[model samples]
Target: MGNFDIKDFKGVIPAVLTVFDKNENIDEVGMRQLISYLIEKGVDGLYLTGSTGEGFIMDSEERKRVVEIVIDEASGRVPIVVHVGAIGTKISIDLAKHAEAVGADGISSVPPFYWKFNENQIVKYYEDIANSCNLPMIVYNVPLAGLLGMNVIKRLASIDNVKGIKYTGMSHYEITQIKDEIGKDFLVYSGCDEMAMSGLLAGADGIIGSFYNIMPELFINIYNAISEKDIEKAQRLQRQAVEIILYSLKVPSFYAGMKAVLRWRGINAGYCRRPFENLTEEEEKEFKEGYKRIKETYKITGVEFLDEL
Candidate 1:
C-alpha cells in the first residue's frame, strides 16, 4: 500500500478547471502551462475532474487522459486528488485504479449520481473503490449529486481508507456534527470558495475550490493567516476573496470567468468546454474591470507580488 494518507492532503487544493480549445479539445500545452503557473503561485494541491473541472461531461478515456496529463505536469510537486465519481460502479472503480496507476496522490469521488442511493449502497460503493487502490480516498458530498445526505456522509467516513469528506452542501455546523460524531481523523474540506473561511473556522482542514485556480495567493494567505492564529487577517482576506466570487457568479460560467482572467494574465488557457457557456464579450469586459476592482480593492496585486517571491 502507498504511504500516502490524509495528513498530506491538507491545505488549499483547487478543483482545477480543464482548459479547452475553441473546438472543445483539451489543450495539453495550455494545461501544462496552467499547472506550472498554479504551482508557481504556491497552491498546495490539485483536484482534477471534479465539478469545476466538468468531469461528468467527459467520457472515461477523457477523464483518465486528463488525470494523466495533470499528474505528468505536476510531477509529484503537489498532491493530485483525482475525482473518479461516475454513475456506474465499474467505471468508478476503473477510474480509481487508473488514478492509482498514474501516480495520483489520492482519489476523491462523489457518490452514485442520478439515482437516490441508500446509505449502505453508497458505503459499499466507496469501500469497493478504496479497496481497489492504495491511495487515500476522499468522499465528495456534492449537493447536486441528489443522493448524499447526512447519513451517507457518516456511513462513508467510517469506511476504511476513507479519510476525508469534501463538504459542499448545507452548513458548516452540519459538517461539524459529522466530524464530532466521527472523530477528528476524518478530514473535512470546504468545497465552496465563498465558504472557505467559515468552514475553516468550523474545523475544516482546508478547501477544495474552483476560484482558488484564479486567486490562489489570496486563499493561501487566508489559510496561512488562520494557521498562524491571525484571525483578523484571515477574515479580511476572506471578505476580499468572497467579493470576487460574488461577481464571478454573475458571469456566464464561473469556470469561464476564471479562464478569462488567466488569459488576461497571458496564460492562454483557452475557453470552457461546450454546453458550458463561455464568457460573452460584455462579460469578458466586465470580468476585466471586476478583476481590476478585486485587485485594487483587496490589495491582491500586493498579495501576488509576495507570492512571486
Candidate 2:
C-alpha cells in the first residue's frame, strides 16, 4: 500500500466490513464512522476490503475508492492493509499499485479463487502482485476456496516483499508449524474470531477477523492478557468473544446479522450486498432481542465505544 515495509504489524486488525447503502453502493459516511470507532476503541491496525469487506464483489475502482477513504480517515493513526485480490492477475496488480500510490501501509490478497491453478501458477500470481508494488504483502490463506499447502506458502514467503499471512483456518498446530518453518519473525495473523484466544497461545502474532468491527476491545484485551501471561483473563475474554460469534451465527445470515448488531449499537453498519441475504422483519426482531441480551446480560461491548467516534 505504501513504499515502506509492513513494520511487522501485530495485535488485532479487523478485516473491516464495507458498509453499503440500499442500492449496494459504498456508504462513505457509515464506513468512516466504523473506522473511527475501531481506531478509537484501540484496534492495533485495520485490514480493508478483505473477504469480510466483500472485496471480490467490488469493481477495481470501487476497491480503490474504499482504500482512499480508509487511508484518508485513518490518516496514519494505525497501519492500513488493503486487500487487493481479484480473480485476474492484471486486476490484482492494478489494485496493488493503486494501493501503494494512495499511501496504504501494506497490501494483501487471497490466492486465486474458483479455479484449481497449479502450485507454480499460484506462486507466479503472488510473485507478480508482490513485484508490482513496493508495499509489503500478506498472503491470505482462506480455507473457503481451499487451504493453501505449507509447501506452497513457503514458496510464496520466499518472495522479497511477501512478509506474512492471514490464516483463516482454526488449526493452531498449523500456525505453529508455519512459525517453526518460516521462522518466528514472520507475521502470522489468525482469522477466526471464535478462536482468537487459543490462536494467540498457538503462536499467532495477531488476529484479523470480522467480529472485531463490533467488539474490538474483547480481542484487544485478550491480546494484552496473553502478553501479560494472565491466562484466566484471556480465557474469560475469549469466551465472551465466542459467545457473540456463536449467537450471531444463529441468524439468517451472519454477515447481515452482524450489520444488524452494529445498527443496534448505533453505528449505521448498513446492509450486506446481494447474495449475502438480509434478515427478515421477524429475523430482525429476533436479532435485536439477542443483542439486548448481549449488551445487558452478556455485556457485549461497543455500545459505549461509539461516544467519541
**Which candidate has the top score in lDDT?**
2
Error of 2 at 265 (Å): 2.2
Task: Find the candidate with the highest TM-score and give its number.
Answer: 2
Off by over 4 Å in 2: 1-5, 293-309
Report clash pairs, candidate 1. Answer: none
Instruction: Give the per-residue lDDT of model 2 (tens digit) for 78-141.
Output: 8889898877999999999998999998889998888888899899999999999898999999
Give per-residue lDDT, candidate 1, residue 272.
82
Question: What lDDT is reached at residue 137 by model 1?
Answer: 93
Q: Tell me the tens digit of each residue's lDDT in model 1 across 176-294.
A: 88779988888888887887888888899878899888788889988898889999988888887777788778876888888887887778778888888998888787667766666
Q: Candidate 1: which stretches are off by over 4 Å?
A: 1-4, 293-309
- Give the C-alpha miss distance for residue 37 in model 1, angstroms: 1.0
How many clashes show up in model 1? 0
Clashing pairs in 2: none
Prediction-by-prediction clash tally:
0, 0
Q: State each model's CA lDDT, in order.
A: 0.83, 0.85
